[model samples]
Target: MLISFGEHAKVVRLEILSKIGEGLQDRESGDRNTD
Candidate 1:
């Protein structure tokens, strides 16, 4: 099995987006706790 460069890039982008989403969710929850 093999992956192309474009396909690899797509996977990398998705991983990055998911990480960013998690960070945002964590920040929002932290703010709620502070209040």
Candidate 2:
């Protein structure tokens, strides 16, 4: 049970990181478009 919980946490962390990365990329592209 503990192992499963740990794995779940890792997955959630990875998802959050990916989402943040995508957001940064979107902002960067938006800035380029404005210029």
**What TM-score fits each model?**
0.90, 0.84
Q: Rate the local accuracy (lDDT) of all candidates.
A: 0.99, 0.95
Worst 10 residues of 1 by lDDT: 1-10
Candidate with maximal TM-score: 1
N/CA/C clash count, model 1: 0
Give the alpha carbon lDDT tens digit for every residue of 1-35 in model 1: 79999999999999999999999999999999999
**True-structure RMSD, every candidate:** 0.8, 2.4
After aligning candidate 1 to the native by TM-score, how far in Å is the CA of 7 from where it should be? 0.2
Score candidate 1 by TM-score against the native.
0.90
TM-score (C-alpha, index-matched) for candidate 2: 0.84
